[model samples]
Structure formats: C-alpha cells, structure tokens
Target: MHDPIFSKSFTRTQRHRFGAIFLCFIIALAISKPPLHLLSPIGDAVKTQLSINNVGNMLLVDDGGRANIKPIADVNPAEYLQLPSDDAQNKRTSTTISAYSDNGIKMEKKHAIICKNSNYCKIEGDVRIDAKSSTILVATSFANMTKSWCVIEPYPRRGTSRVKKWRVATLEKNDISLPICTQHHTHPSLLFSMGGFTGNYFHDFADILFPLHLTSSQIQKKVQFLATDYKQWWINKFDKILNKLTKHNILDIDRETSQVHCYNELQIGLKFHKELLTLNSSPSMHTFKVLLREAYSLKRERVIRDINVPMPRLMIIDRKRTRVLTNEHQVLRIARKLGFEVVEGVATDLSRFAEAVNSCDVLVGVHGAGLTNMVFLPDNAVVIQVIPFGGVDGFARLDFGNPAKGMNLRYLEYKIRENESSLSRKYSRDHPILRKPELYRNWDQVWSIYLNQQNVSVDLRRFKGILVEALTLLYYK
Candidate 1:
C-alpha cells in the first residue's frame, strides 16, 4: 500500500514553496512594469517574432515565418479533383504559350494570357487564362476591388485592353475575405498587369539588346558576382540574401507585378561600400560614447534639413508593399534635414541594408523585411515605423527587440487610421475574399501595436529626446 501522506507531504511542500516564490515574483514584476515585458506571453510572442531562431524540425515558410501543417483533412485519393487529358478543353488547357526559334533551341517568347475573369479581362503573366481562378501562381488574372483597375508593381508595362469581350473578375473584399477572382461578361473590363519581361528583376536584362532571359543559372552568376567583388561583406551576408531571394520568389510574388527594382551589376556592388563609409562617418553613431553621457549632462542638437525631400524630424513610412524611395533619395531627405550630407545606401545584397541603416541617427520605413535592417543598427539608434494602410503580417519580425545590450530603442508610428498592429491583423479581419482564422491573417498584428494605440504610446517629443541624447553621445564614440 502506498503511503498517501508521503505523496501529499511532498506535493503540499512543493506547492507552498512555488506559491511563495510566485508571490515574490509577482510583486517584483508589478514594481518594474517592465518596458520589455520579458515575462508576458505577448512579450514572448514579440520576442519570438523579433529574435527567436527556428531550430531542427522547426520549418520556416512564407518568408521566415513558422512552418505549419495544412488544416484540411486527408483526401480520398479516388475523389480528388483531376484534370482530364483526352478532352478538348483539357488538351487546350496549357495556360502557357511558348514561341520558340525554328531550331527549337531558343525561346522567343512565352506568354501567359487570360481573356477574362468574373468581370475583368487582363493578361496575368506571360501566360493568359480565359477561365476564372480564385488564386493564381501569378496575378495575371483580372481582379476587381471596390472598382476595376489594374494593379502592377516592380515593373509596370500593361494597358487596359479596349476589347469589351471580357470583364474584371468580381472580388468580394471585406472583413473575412481572401481576395479571389470571379467572372463577368458585362461591365468595365480591368486590364490587369502583365508578367515576365524578365523572370525576376533581380538581374534580368530585358532592356539589353540580347536581354539575358534569366534562369537559376543566371541568378547564380549574380550571386557569384556579389561573392567575388563584395567578398568581405558577401561572405557574411550570403545566407541572408539567398533566403530572402528564394522566399520572395516562392511567395508574396505576383509574377505579374514582381521584378527586380534594381539589378545593374555596377550599381549593386557600389551600394554596400557607399553606406559602410557613411555609417562609420555618421555623427548619429556614438554607441560607445552615449553610455557615458548619463554620468554627466550633455545635450546635442543641430539644425537639419532634408537635402532632397524634406523629411520631418519624425517621418514614418512603409516598405513591404513597395519601396518607392531610393536609398540616396531617402537618406538625402532625412540626413540633409538633420544638417548632414545626403546619404545613399546601395543594396548589392542583404548586408548592405544593415550598413546603410547604421549610418543614420534615425531610420523610418514600413512594416517590411527591409526594416529588419534595424537589427544591425548601431546601438542608440531611433526607429520610426509606418504600418501599411491595408496590410498585415503575423510572422513578420523587426530588429527593434529590447535595445541590443547597450542600445536605446525608440519607435514612432504613423498610420492611415487609428488601428495599429502588424499588417497581418489588419487584413485578417478584412481580406477582400477566402479569409479564415488560422491562415486568414498572419495574426501577427494581434501582438504588435501602433505607436498611438492605447496599449502603446510613442510621441515625437520623446523621440527627439532620444535623438538629442544620441547626438550628445557621438562626440565620445
């Protein structure tokens, strides 16, 4: 017979000890009201997003986001939908049309065409579709939002078709919507964007006479170029760049709108060196010196003006959706405003992003991966973030986690509305079409808040105070 007293005795003592420690911990936690919320689960999620690494068996998909198991139940092999091979429609089902040289050794052109969708008509990619598809590998299908208009990016080279034979696909956009395509025969046709001038802009040469139609081999060549010339920086940043490029290619890419914003070989290499020099020389960097300022009172403020576009003392913008400003353009505006020479940071690869950010006293941009550069910023840097007007992300992480050991982190956010959170949350509640809970929205915003949200408030005055302190410390570094 087991002694109940023994089991109860240890259990009781363990509970009592744990309870006592818990009380003390709670008391200490209350006293601190910690800025980082080290113990809060929300904080943990934040930390997870910002700094946690995925280990073995932990998969990352959707651009460094956590891996997930598909929720749909196992399919009955016999019942699975299958495309017919012998049927006329199925035989003509090749969505892609390829024009090759007589020798068949060369591809003259490969076009993906789409004649119609719900109420829209447009070319999706190099391939065209005459049928309706809810989601597509590339957004070549005509999709209607509140109204009908073609949306394109990276490169824009499509004009709405004048033909009245088709119309834009009806898209029901609202909360709980995962924008999809529909078909309509009567209405204004949306001539959506085209695709594949070059597979991806990263290094494609559609502009050249013998435009280097690209392949994995071509991208590899560019990667090699980066490694060879920018050897020092490239070695350290290759993994980051490779991961970013591959994932970008797989997801979040609308073959219709995706292109390399900049792919010139010369331009790519120069981007890194220019920023490295700038960051090392920037007065904004004095991480080592700023630490000592607390012991003695030192205040530094200098009049600044944007060299190109005048950026307010505090400017918040977004980057994920599209990067409209060039490095030099952006740096010139903000740095000049602060009385520094206009700065330009180039991106031959990923690390250049870090070098560029470290050159500034303050950095501002959207809730996109580029801002992840903040992780590499010199300690004592100030960051201003802008949430997308209608975008959300769950796994998106930024580098502004608890001020790196000796760093002081500050955040300023501006938005189209009062709602503040990661873009994932914004869309989760209102995707235009197929939105669901687990995958509907990244749900990341549930953890993130805008600077003005009741839960988190960051004002300009406080921001400037950090700048002032940062500037004061630069003299020592």
Candidate 2:
C-alpha cells in the first residue's frame, strides 16, 4: 500500500543510522581499553626515550659545565609501557647498562639489572656514581632507580643534595625495547673526589680518619681503600695497622671512584666510639696499641724505662691553629729548661714524626687536632692535654681522657684559668664573655669566642706544678 521508492529510502536511512551507532560504540570501547601496541614489545628507540621519574628530569650538562636540557613531549603509554610484574612469569631477569658521567667518564659501564616495581627499580650488585664535584660509593644487593640512585635508604647524611646532581643513562639493549636503566656513574678518582684543601688541618688529617674507623665493624670481609693518592706521611706510616686489621684485603682503586661490596657504613666524628670499642677480639685500646707498636717495631720492655737517667724523652706539640700559645717562645724556653725537647709537632714527613713520637715518654699539646698524633707514642707514655676555656671540662674528658685510659696511657688535663686566657684582655670583666659562662650552651658561639679565636699564655709558675706532676707520673709509673 505504500510507494515503493519511499519504502526503499526509509530502509536505507535506518541502515545508515544503525551503522553510525555501531561505529560510536566501537570508538568508546577502544578509548576505555589499553592499546594493542602496549601489549607488543617496545622498540629500542622507545626504550632510550623512557622517562626516568624523579632522577630523569635532569639538565644534561656538557664538558664545559654547561647544562642542555631539551624539551621532550610527555611520554605516551602506548609508546612507552611499563612491563608487567609477572611479564616473564616472575622469573629473575638480568641485563647490563652503561652509566655516563658529566666528564665523559663511564662508571659501572656494565651493571647487573635486578627488578623493577611501580615505585622503584633495583640494580643488583655494588656501583659507584660520579658527578662533576662528588663521588658516591654504594654497597647493597640492589640500588634504587627512583628518587635518588641510592642503594642505602635515607641516603648519606653528608652529601644528600650533592647526590641529586647526577645525570644517569642506560646502554641500549637488543632484546629489551627499553634499556634497563642502571643507577651508577664515575669520576676521575677518589683523591680529587674526597675533598680539596680545607685549610683546616684538624679536619683534613684527623677528623677525616674518623669516618673510615666508623666502617670497621660494618665491613664484613673487604675494604676498597680510596684516595690513596693523598697518602702522605701519617697515612703511609699508620696504614700498616689498617692493613693488619683488614687482613691485607684492602684493594686500591687508586685515582678512580669505586664502590666495594660488603662494606656498609661511613660517618664522621667520634660518634661511633662505643661501636669502635666492640670491634675486635681484644679491647679496641689494647688491640690498637699493640698494632701500632707492631707497625713501628717497638718492644713492650722499651716502654718502661729507668727513672733516674733521663732516658725518657718529652715532646711538646706546637699548634699552628686557634687556641694556640700566645707566648710559645717563652713556653718553649721553660720546656727546654726542664730538659724536655720541644718538637714543632707538625710533621711533613710521617716517618720522622712517628720516630719522634714513638721515642718520647711524654707528649704534650694544647686541646687541638695535633694531640691526635699521641697515637704514635709508646704504650705507657704520658699525655698532657692543655684544655682551653669556656667549660671544656666534660668534653676534654670524653674526647681524650677515656681513650688514653683505655690505651694504658697516663692522661693529664691542664685547665686554663681565666687570667691565663687571652679573652680576658679583649672582653670587659663584666661582659657576657667573662661572666655568663653558661651561655656557652651554643657551640658555635663558644667556638667563635673561646675555642676558635682565643689564645693563651700559660702562667709559667702555675703550669710548672702540672709539668712536675706529669713528670712524676712518667718517672714513677
């Protein structure tokens, strides 16, 4: 009953509408689901372009200390897909990657790949990462490839910000579409990387060794001694003791930044004194003293000498830093008059220094790093520490008193009376520097006014009594 042409037109229109609806449904499904390209293996080029989350956004620096960071488009999931956790059926996978440095030095060129997760990627084995100004040594089964290329959690306390300045990359792989990015870098060597001339002799020579001592117990079997190029008088002489304790497994990675496995700790200061006390079979004091004597080839019988013949030598440490003797010439004159040999205490030749200290019966020094050389003295030697002002009583006892007692050495501290300090000349008698000594609770303020800037002239008449006391202990004991 309807016109045939009109019926055909209506049927064609219905078919066109149905086809458009089906196409729209297909588009929606495709949008909701992951792309098929994500399922396929990623290409090598795509891997190289993989975005490194926190560490990846680095400013690529050139040889002349210039950074060149190009603006790349945001990564697409289809082009750069994260591998499934069970991609290889949870099987352990391994790969190698090269780590580049700003100076074109390649550190850990071949790193063993471990695994990756959403938050972090781990690299198996030890690695050293170097930057323009710093070198880091990491020791762990796996390294973090996320925020910071750190193996140890919480990173190193001293160089946390410096560690973040590294630009890391991975060598191309054939089987894997993305290069298994490893977190490692390299530098010229440990010597240049440790530090430059700090101008602080105490920090340069003595305080530097404290961190190495902190790693004694954490080092299970091996120690890769770095910065051997800086080895000089004291380091060369005392390294024999280190060699004996570490059992000669101290491999020298000289002039190159390196990370040795099985060693786990590094810290500054004598904060680990308690831990150091428990390291070896014997007490640390006895063990260290014996090792030192062995290194210098001295006998126990030689330490104890005849009291009447003046066979024992006395050495006085003359400091070149703060809190020094204002009238050192006069002090030296008195020392010589008392038949004590006054040594400069600062030695460029460690062998000569060792010989001088080892031969002496009494070692005397103001409260400074120079006193650290007392380690070279004979077992029963007497140590006279001249304590500076500003409430150093407790600190003096903790720093040297306990250690000397432990090492079987007679320790004597000469506290500086107010009249003896040079501060008395500069500040008014009623000034806070003179009166409110309790304000020394702030270490920096105390250091500025008393320890770092002040000097002293010992009241010779009063100091002679302490000198006599030291001699009595050395002669009688």
Which one is best on lDDT? 2
What lDDT would candidate 1 get against the real structure? 0.27
| Candidate 1 per-residue C-alpha lDDT over 28-73 given as tens digits, one digit per residue, 9 for 90 to 100 | 3322331210111111111122221231111100011211111122
Q: Which ten residues in a row have the lowest lDDT in candidate 2?
A: 59-68
lDDT of 2 by residue, 305-328 (tens): 665666457777765546777776
RMSD of each candidate relative to the true structure: 26.2, 20.9
- Residue pairs in collision within model 2: 47-178, 129-185, 130-185, 189-255, 189-256
